[model samples]
Target chain A: MTGLLVGLGRASLSVFERLGRGHLFLLRILLGLAALVRRPRLLVVQVWSVGVQSLLIIVVAGTFVGMVLALQGYNTLITFGAEQSLGVVVAKSLLRELGPVIAALLFAGRAGSALTAEIGFMKATEQLSAMEMMAVDPVRRIVVPRFVAGIISMPLLAAIFTAVGVLGGHFCGVGLLGVDEGAFWSQMQAKVTLLDDVVNGVMIKSLAFGFVVSWIAVFEGYDAVPTSEGVSAATTRTVVHSSLAILALDFILTGLMFN
Target chain B: MKDPRLMEISVGAFVAIGLAALLLLALKVANLAQFSPPPGYEVKAYFDNIGGLQVRSPVKMGGVLVGRITNIGFDSKRFQAVVTLRISQIYNSIPADTAANIYTAGLLGEQYVGLEAGGDDTSLVAGDEITITQSAVVLEKIIQEFLYSKTTKSASPGS
Candidate 1:
């Protein structure tokens, strides 16, 4: 009984310690972000690496998701003789839920893991130590640019995902299924609104998710042990933790914004 | 130098496309063209049960959307739902005595307010109440009625 109690206490203490460290890490990343205003070149390069590189996957996946949505929604809506609302279902599904959430998940997997691996590699190779010896704050120099790029790129990526998704839905619903093209577009237009669905749901969710994803990526990379296996393990943890965080954050943000 | 220039150009185009995508989304979502519609006037309608009618549901006149429902409230005294609609000034020609109905678009779809023109020449201005209204048809209530009548008819076949 005593041993069990001692073990439980140790677990709780370690959990609290980890939480405290995570909080401090976030604070430093925020400070680093504030310092990024003077480092526009760094920001651009990170955006190129993270955002530009992730574009094709975001677009292709977005289109396929939208196409599937159109096909499935048409089948379901036809049951009640309400096939005319395929556009509304497709648009709302993408904009309110799928667009931001899926984009963030993909970003977490693709860009987030990449950021972790690159920074972890730097740490493993003693580059981070070399930077520290040169009086450079690695957080400010390396982590901040990636974080800022993520925050800006997420919403853009989500918007692109949704737009392409809508077009894909249109293609399936109108082009293949012979759903009236005008009705499909007009019904979608008449229902979805910028202020309610797009700005709050898509834009805000992406921003929050972007911050969380990059923060996890950077923190995992920064805290990694300086060994080859350790760096690889950190990379894996970055992807796993970032993806879970994205999904959990998506749920929380959706409830907060729409509810 | 040339590689960096090409990268920058690609980055620029990427950002531009994303921005363009946002623009298209906003346009489609708002149902606005390049230009926005002018500010509109307001009107009110009452219903026994608004059912699933929501704020921002389109207000249509003769199959054309002229406005949107701005607010939904309860008239406690009359035990009815009060819906306020903001009609665009371009569609200010709705007769003063016109009636409104809460209509679902395509079966099982979103609900909107459909206005039926009365013979009166004087058009409704801001804050006029559309007294005559048909509330939303709740399917459960409809099914209950259908089942009840069927059972009653079967019980008394000669009648």
Candidate 2:
């Protein structure tokens, strides 16, 4: 028991130390430089993988969550005679918390793991070493594009999720639940603000999460040994670290922004 | 060779489409107008407590939403909660004697401002203050009162 506790303590310390390193800042700078350098082909590949591939999942998940929120909120409010607040609950919860956080988690599961595995495989196969021998800056050529794509993609995806979620909530709350249609919309319009909280929170959280994901993927990839086992381990660690970082950062950002 | 430049172009197109979809969704949301309050007339109410009174909370008159709660604040001097409501222009002719009451719909349910129309012929104007009000009857207080009364009744009967 004592050994297990000590091991957990060491692991926690290592995670903090790794996070404190300038990897995230370096990633941001590399992404900026790549944007300036402008490799159109890499950008296109990223756009396909990050944006186009993600659409269907985001739409389906966002809509269902919204519907559930409406159904549950309406049922509870109806008992007390305040059923019209359904719109407010659905809109506020989606815009403020669900949209960005859920989208980021989904993206990490899909894209972050794939990114880590691809790079880890390249390292195991000595492809990265060959690139280094050829005087290529692997960070510039490999990490920067994916990092830039993640930052750009997350916010756009979050926005889509939020919009879809709100529509779904409206469908469930007013159409199915029989909330006064006018009352539902008017409450939404009055409460939901573009600049005040929703947009700002989404933008900041998405960007921070994107950085964490990309940084974890690259760090795990670079550290992988030249073995299949090493590659698998790196991929698993990347997903776990990135997802936890996204959740932790979410709480911190929410406290700072809302409090 | 699968030209990387072609891939980049395709990705850019995809991003543009995604953004367009979002814009379209935004427009759709904007167009789905249901409960918009009418312009020019506003009613303000005061409450002792407004639990679950969220921004965009509905303000109803006889089960019809006439307006929305646009703002909430505390009047430090009076030690009361002030709620600003924007009534629809159609309902501009509310009587000056209208009473606003904060009530809960259910246990652990949302709270809203319920407007009880007055019999007075004089109509309320914009920026009118609703002075006649009933504060929210909190569940805890009601439960405590009920329990206290029950205990006293049982004790007196036994004695």
Candidate 3:
């Protein structure tokens, strides 16, 4: 019993310590934002790596999700003779929930893991230490750009995901299933609003997810033990932790925005 | 990573595509244009009960949407629901004697204001009051009245 209590206390303390360190790391990156703006090339390169490279996966995943939603929604809606509302179901689901959440989950697995691996490798090779020796802040030179790139790329990727998802829903709903085209478009337009559904739901949610995911990735990388095994562990942790963070933040944001 | 120019081009394309997707969502899906009230005129109508009528509900003339409900308020003295409709600028030829009625779209659909035009030469301008109006039909009330009438008739004959 005494051993179990001691173990619990130690675990809790470590968790709190890591949380404090993560916040401090985020603050340091934010403090370097002004310097990062002057050299936009760094951001552009990171965005290319993060956003452009991830486009194909986002689009493909979005299409499949949307198509599946239409198929499932149709089967259910047709029972009540309200299949015309399939568009509303599909669009609202994508814009309000699935688009941001799923996209963020994907981003965590893809870009978040890659960022952790890259930064971990840099630390393992003493690249960050070399930058520190050269009178450059490693946080500013290395971390801030990748963090800012994640923030910028996430919303754009989510928006693209939603758009492609809507098209996929349309193809399954109207083209394949022979639902009325006018009813599909009109119902969606009537229900979904730019301010409430798009801006607040999709954009804001993605932005928050982006911030959380990037912060976790960079912090895990920076805090890792400088060894090959440690780098692998950090990469795995970045994906796991960020994915959990995205889901928790999504619930909170949804309640605040939708309610 | 090697080719900077190619990287820059791809990044720009990605950003452009993202913006384009947002535009499509705003226009094609959300229909942003519907939110912005067109240059138009406002008219008021009073109803006994608006039922499920809500602001931004489409205002139709002859089964065609020409405007939207701008506001809904209550007239305490008259004990009636006052609804304001904003007709689009292009549809300026609505007659002064138009009768506004609250109507449900389908069995379980949203309600809207439908205008039935009368043969009047004069056109309605801003803030014009439409005197002739029909309140929304309430299903519960109709059922209650029907049951009451049937019971009364049966009891009266027996008495």
Candidate 4:
């Protein structure tokens, strides 16, 4: 009984310690952001790296998901003699579930991992230490801009994904399958509510996911030991941890927003 | 020759694309675009049972949609669902005795208010009440009734 209680206490203590660390980390990143106001180039470069570079990948993946949904949804809906509602099927699935989750997964793999690797590599090369030696805080100079860029990029990536996906669905459902174009668009407009699906479900969900993925990424890179293997491990851990955090947060946010 | 100004263009383009995507989603998927009905008039309908009826249900005339249900409410005193319809000015010929019925859009999909034209020469106008309205047929209730009737018929056919 005493052992179980001790184990429980240790778990709670570790969780509390992690919470405290994350809070302090966020505070420092905010300070770093404040320091970057004079030098806007740093922020712009990070946005270019984090956001602009990821566009093609997001678009291609979104299109594939949309086309696949049309093919699959058509088959199932036809079984129920509801092929007309293919628009609803594709639109609801993308906005409510796939858009945020898949976008975040891709973001984690692409930009999030890249961030971890970049930061970790700097730590491994003693560049961060050198900056410290020069009386320049590495966190303020390096971490904050990347964090902000990730936050900004996520919702944009998700929006582009959803838009391209819709077009893909339109191509497959209307052009290929010969479903009425009017029905495809009109039914979607009639049924899908703006505030419920887009604002709360897709946009809000993706933003939260963005914060989690980037937070995990930047933290992993920052905390890594100064070694080549440690840097590589940090990159790997960034991908794995960010992916998991995104999915878990997706579930929680979906429940809160939809229900 | 990678100009630093190249980034400015890309960033601007990115913001433009983001806003455009948002506009498209809002217009197409979320149905926020004002497909503005060219001026309209309000009409009310009362139903004994609304079933799954909701606001924004399309008001169809002669199998063609002419307006939308703008509001839905429960009238406790009347013990009925009060539905407010907004009919397009383009479809102003609806008679005074026209009947409104709640219908599923695609057999089993979303519900809408479908209006059936009546024989009265007098046309309906703003703030008019559609006295003749039929509520939606609940499928489960219909199935249950069918099953119950079958059991009873098999048990007591001679009567």
TM-score of each: 0.87, 0.69, 0.96, 0.91
Stretches > 4 Å off in candidate 3: B150-159
* Model 4: per-residue Cα lDDT over B93-132, one tens digit each: 8899998988886677788888888999999999999999
Estimate how well candidate 1 is docked, as a DockQ score. 0.62
Enumerate the candidates' DockQ scores in order. 0.62, 0.25, 0.87, 0.68
lDDT of 1 by residue, A13-94 (tens): 9879867887798898887777788878888888888998999999999999999999999999888887788899999999
Q: Which ten residues in a row have the lowest lDDT in candidate 2 chain A?
A: A190-199
Chain B vs. true chain B: TM-score for each candidate? 0.85, 0.77, 0.90, 0.88
Model 3 lDDT per residue over B89-123, tens place = 99998899999999999888899999999999999
TM-score of candidate 2 against the unseen true structure = 0.69
| Candidate 4 CAPRI classification by DockQ | medium
Ranking of all predicted structures according to DockQ, beginning with the best and ending with the worst: 3, 4, 1, 2
Q: Look at candidate 2 and give me any clashing residue pairs.
A: A41-B4, A44-B8, A80-B105, A80-B106, A182-B34, A182-B35, B38-B88, B38-B89
What's the lDDT for residue B47 in model 3?
96
After superposing candidate 1 on the true structure, give the runs of residues whose Cα lies further than 4 Å from its correct spot.
Answer: A1-16, B30-37, B76-79, B131-159
Error of model 2, residue A164, in angstroms: 5.0
Output the better candidate (1/3) by DockQ: 3
Q: Please give the distance, in angstroms, between residue B109's alpha carbon in candidate 4 and its true position after superposition.
A: 2.8
List runs of model 4 lying over 4 Å from the truth.
A1-19, B35-39, B141-159
Candidate 2 ranges with C-alpha deviation above 4 Å: A1-37, A56-99, A124-136, A161-197, A200-202, A226-229, A254-259, B1-56, B70-83, B88-91, B103-109, B116-123, B138-159
**Candidate 1 lDDT tens digits, B27-78:** 8754656235458888888799998998778889888888888899998999
What RMSD value applies to candidate 2? 5.6
Candidate 1: residue A53 Cα off by (Å): 0.8
State in Å the error of residue A93, model 3: 1.1
> Where does the lowest 10-residue lDDT sum fall in candidate 1 chain B?
B29-38
